[model samples]
Target: MQQIKIKQYGNAQEAFAFEEQEKPVPIDSQLLIQVEGFGLNYADVMARNGLYKDAPKIPFVPGYEVVGKVIQCGKGTPPDFIGERVVAFTRFGGYAEQAVGDFRAARIIGDRISGGEACALATQYCTAYYMTDYISNLHEGETALIHACAGGVGTALSQLCRRKGVTVIGLCGSEEKVAFLEAMGVDFIINYKKNNYKKLIENRLGKRKIDYIFNTVAGNSFKEDMKLLNYGGKIYCFGGAARSGKKDHILNDLAFLLKTGFVSPLFMMMKSHGVIGVNMLRIADNHTAVIGKCLGELHQLWLQGEIKPVVGATFQASQIGEAHQLLESGKSMGKIYVYW
Candidate 1:
């Protein structure tokens, strides 16, 4: 088996090294997938830079999702799963030619779906589904704000909100993304780089307060979102893209934390505002079944044409460095996939 390993923590080009390794065998309820390709998440970039706390130590493979055929199944797994084409959620090890994942986290895909689309269903769409359907209740006539609204999860969230008849206020960093979201039928698009998103959203909404906010850029944005939230509104914090590009030092980490500021439980209670933090890795660790349910539901939605996965770009496994660089650049509009 061949895999890309993180040799060191720094820029993408200097951090990765290709190497040959023995193929891993699945154990317990796990399945070994002959990986066709894998998807890139922002966490992979954070892992490469040594910013993700839960990432494995140096020399480890960094990937969250894989689309491939099931070649082998472990104990308690069904033999019928063998030879099935599926998308699976890998804890790490997904950067290799083969990877193992809990059978419960794997879902079969039809020939109609491309590998890049299947990869989106694993981590990105599942995360969006878990937040929108599992954790929060979205209703018709409500308004929601989505950060990074042109990326993988953001695209998924936007479509999901649309299905529920909720108006979407999408925030992006570039005009290209604004056009992309506009084509996707986003109710409103704000280029945060060119204008104050807070004022723009306020001007657009007038007296209507946001009912929900899907925030990936944590920092001063959290405080800003709180101000725009309605009494019953809730904000979901999932990523810290704002922390990227900081100096590799403890002081820099602390400074980023300070910028996010602190929240008081008493204040939130009195104001009737709620803050929810989502770390899918932790959820997968303690409640694997929840992830399985989310994946299954998302798969059904895709099959029904209720949601579409956006493939921003594709790269060969040898171009892993390029993939990381593009994802880190935040210029890619949708999911980026690296194929073996």
Candidate 2:
């Protein structure tokens, strides 16, 4: 089997090395898959930069999702699952021609879906579904704000919100993203790079306030979102893209944390505001069943045409460095993946 390994922590070109290794066998409740491709996420960039705390040590594989066919099934897994074409969430080790993952984290898909589309469902769409449908009770006529609203999970979140009849305020860093959101029928689009998003949102809402906020940039935006939140509104923090790119710098990390500031539960209780943080990796660790459920629901949604996963770009296996560079640049509009 051939796989891409993180040889060191630094830039994408210097960090990865290709190597041959023995094909891994599935253990209890696991499935061995012949991977077609794997998707890239912002966390992969963080991992390459040695910034993600949960990432495996050096020389480890660093992918989270893959679209593949199950070639073998392990003990406690259903035998019928063999030969199924599925999209699966891998803890790691997905950047290879073959991989193994827990059967609970895999869901069957049809032949019509492309590898990029299937890869989108495994991690990005599942994360969106888990946050919108499983955890929150979103209602019709409500308003929600999505930060980084042109990316994979952001696109999924916008579509899910639209299905619920909620108005979406999509925030992005570029005009191209604003146009993309417009085509997707986002209720409002803000280019934070050119305009002050806080002011724009306030001017548009007038007396009303945001009902829910899906915030991924968590530095100063945390305090800003709190101010714009309506009574009883909740803010979901998922990523910290606002953090400086100085890896392993204690002062820089502290600066980012300080900018996020402090939150008092007492104040939130009095104001009826709520703050919730989401780390999908943590959820996968503690609640494995939830991953399966979310994957199943997202698959159904895609089949019904209720949601669409955009494939920003697809790269060859040899172009792994280019894929990482695009993801790190944050200029890619949707899901980016590399085919084996």
Candidate 2 local lDDT, 1-340, one digit each (tens): 9999999998888899999999988999999999999999888888888888899999899899888899999899988889999888888899999999888988989698999988988888888888899999899999999999999999999999999999999999888888999999999999988998889988988643999999988999988889899899999999888873777688888999999988999999988988999999998888877899999998888899998999999999999999988888878988998998
Tell me the spans in candidate 2 whose CA falls farther than 4 Å from its real position: none
Residue 65, candidate 1: how far off, in angstroms?
0.7
lDDT of 1 by residue, 167-215 (tens): 9999999989988999999998999999998898888776439999999
Which candidate number has the best lDDT?
1
Worst 10 residues of 2 by lDDT: 242-251
